[model samples]
Target: MSHADLLPADVPVQLIDPDGRVTASADALPSPEALLRAHEALVIGRRINDQAYALVRQGRLAVYPSSHGQEACEVAATLVLEQQDWLFPTYRDTVSIVSRGVDPVEVLVLLKGDWHSGYDPVATKVAPQATPLATQLLHAVGVAHAATLRGEDTVVMAMCGDGATSEGDFHEALNFAAVFKAPVVFFVQNNEFAISVPLARQSVAPSLAHKGVGYGVRGQRVDGNDVAALLSVLGAAVEAARSGEGPQLVEAHTYRMQAHTNADDATRYRTDDDVEAWRSRDPLLRSAAYLTAQGLLTDDRVAEMDEKAEQVAAAMRAGLMADVQPDPQELFQHVYAEPTPQLREQAAFLAEELSREDAV
Candidate 1:
C-alpha cells in the first residue's frame, strides 16, 4: 500500500455523531447483535469506572486511573480479541482487563496494592497491566513475534494512552513489529492528554494514527465515544493483523472525564466547560441511542443492562470493602525459585515475629 493509504482519514471515522444521528455509512458498523453486546459492555464498563473511583475515595485502592469517557475504547479493544489472542494493557486499562473475562476484584489487585498482576496471564492471555508508559508495546511485539515463530495464530493487542506515543519504546515496538510482520495491533486511546500534557504538546503529527506510516504499518482512526464505530474499526484492525497484514495502529479520539487519578486536581489543568462538553458525548449514552434507533435496544433491555451493571458494582464494592490479611512471609516465596539465604532469613524473622504475637 502507498504511504497515503496507511494514513488515517483527515477526520476520524465517526459513524454516529454526538447527537446520536448516523453521520456515516453503516457498511463499517458491526452486526446488530455485536452492537448490542457492545452497548451492554459500555454500561458495565462505566459502572466499573464509577465503582473504582468510589473505592479510591474509600481508601480501598491506592490509586485508580478512571477511563470514564473512554469506555468505548476499552470495551472494543477487549471484544475484538479471540480467546487465544493476547492483550497488553496499561495501568489505566482496568476496565479493559475486567471486560476480558477477569474477575473485577482480581483486576484491582494492582491498584489495591496487594499483588503485581491480579489474574493469571497464561490463563487469561492478558499481560500484567504495565504502569510505565509504552513498555507494554515492546512486550506485545515480542510476544507477537514469538507466536509467529512458533506458528501460533495468536494476535496481540497492545494498548496505550496518547502520551505513550511520545516514548521511544512506542516507535521501537512499531518498527520491530512492522519489520517482522508480527500480528499485533497498537491501539492508542488519544483521550487528548497524557495526564496533564495536552495532545498539542505531545506531537504535532496530523493524528496519532499517522505515526504508523513511518513504520509501514496501516493506520486508522475512530470516534472513541461511539461504541459502534470503535467495535467496527478495532474488529477490522485485529482481523487484518491476524490475516498477515502486519501491525495496525488505531487512534481513538476520546476524552478522560475525571482527574487522572484520585491524587489529581483536574481543575488545575482543565476547565469544567471542557469536562461538561465531553460528558454530553458520553460513550454509554451514544451507544444506547444508536442501539435504540436500531430497535435492538428496548426499554426492557436497557433496564436489564442497568440492573446487571449495578450488581457488578455492588459486588466490586463488597469485595474491596472486605479487609485483606496478607501473609508477610508469602512475599519471599515468589522472589526466587530457590530461596536465597537473605530471603530465607527475612522469612524466618517474620515468621518468628508472628509466632511471638500468637503466643501473646
Candidate 2:
C-alpha cells in the first residue's frame, strides 16, 4: 500500500490550528513539556536568523536567507532526528542545521564568502548548504540508499522549498527512494513564495505534498507554523522511514514574512497586506500563547526566554565578527582527489600572490 493511502486528499492534515488548539485527535499531540521546548527552539532560531539578516545589511555577511517565519519547521525537523541521522539542507535552512548543534560561525561560513563547507560533513552528518536547488535531494537519496544496502538504520531528511520541487533532480531522487525503499524524508517548506514567484506560478499541482504519490512514497501536509503539529508529524515520519517504509514527503504550508534574502525585495511581488495576514499566525506567537494558557510560561518566564534569545543573538554576532584567515591553497582542496595540471597551475598562481603579500 502507498504510505499516504490513508491520508485524506484536499485537506492538509494539521494537528494544531492557528489558535494552538488540537484540531486532530489528542493521541498524536506532543506532550506539553515537548511543546514548550519546541517553542523555545523556534524562538531562538528566529532570533539568530534575524541577527544574521542584520549582519548581512551591515556588510558582514554577503547574504543570508532569513528563516524568520519558518522557524517552527526548522526547529522541529532538527529535533526529531537521531544523532546518527543525516540532514541535507538548502541555503535557506541554516537554521535547521544550526539546531543540530553545529557551530554557529562554521554554519555561516559559506554566507561569509568562504568557498568550501565550514564543517566536516562526515563528522556532523549534515551536508553543506546546497545553493543549487534540489541538488542536495540527490545526495540525500544516495546516502539513504547506501545505508539501506549496508543494513544500517539511518533516516535522512532532505529539505527544500516549493520551487525546488520542479527540478529534475527532485523527481529522480524521490523516484529512486521509492524504488529502493530508501529511508529518506523529503520536507518541502512551502513558504508561499520561492524568491519572487508565488506557488501559484510554480506548479499547478493540487498540493506539493502529492508529488510523492507519483513515486510511490507517502505524503503529508501540515501547517508549517504549528510547532506541535510539525514535531508530531515529522517525528512519526522519521520513525516510519527508519522501519523500511520508504521515502516520505511533507509539504509545510507557510509564509515567508521577510524578503527572499537580504538582497531581494519581497514587496515588489507581494503586498504588505499579504504578509500582515500571516503575522497573526506567526509560529512563536501561537506557541507562546498555548504555553502560557497551559501555565507553562508566566510573564516572568517569557522575559527569561527573551533574554536567552538575546544572548544567542549576541554570541552569533561575536562569532561572525571573529575572522580566520583561510588557507590560500584550500581553494584546490576538494576539487579533485588529485589536482589536475590546470588546477595546480591556478593554485600556484594564487600561492605566489599570497606569498608576495606576506613578504610585504
TM-scores for all predictions: 0.97, 0.94
lDDT of each: 0.91, 0.88
lDDT of 2 by residue, 1-360 (tens): 845492425766677777866677888888978887888788788888889988887778999998888999999999999999999999999889888988778898789988878898999999999999999999999999999888887999999999899899999999999998899999999998879988899898789987787778888888889988889889989999998888888988888889998889888999989999999889998898778767888888777778988988888789888877777687787889988999999999998998999899
Tell me the tens digit of each residue's lDDT in model 1 across 162-238: 99999999999999999999999999999988889999999998999999999999999889998888888899999
Segments in model 2 whose C-alpha atoms lie over 4 Å from true places = 2-8, 338-360
* Candidate 1 off by > 4 Å: none
Q: Give the TM-score of candidate 1.
A: 0.97
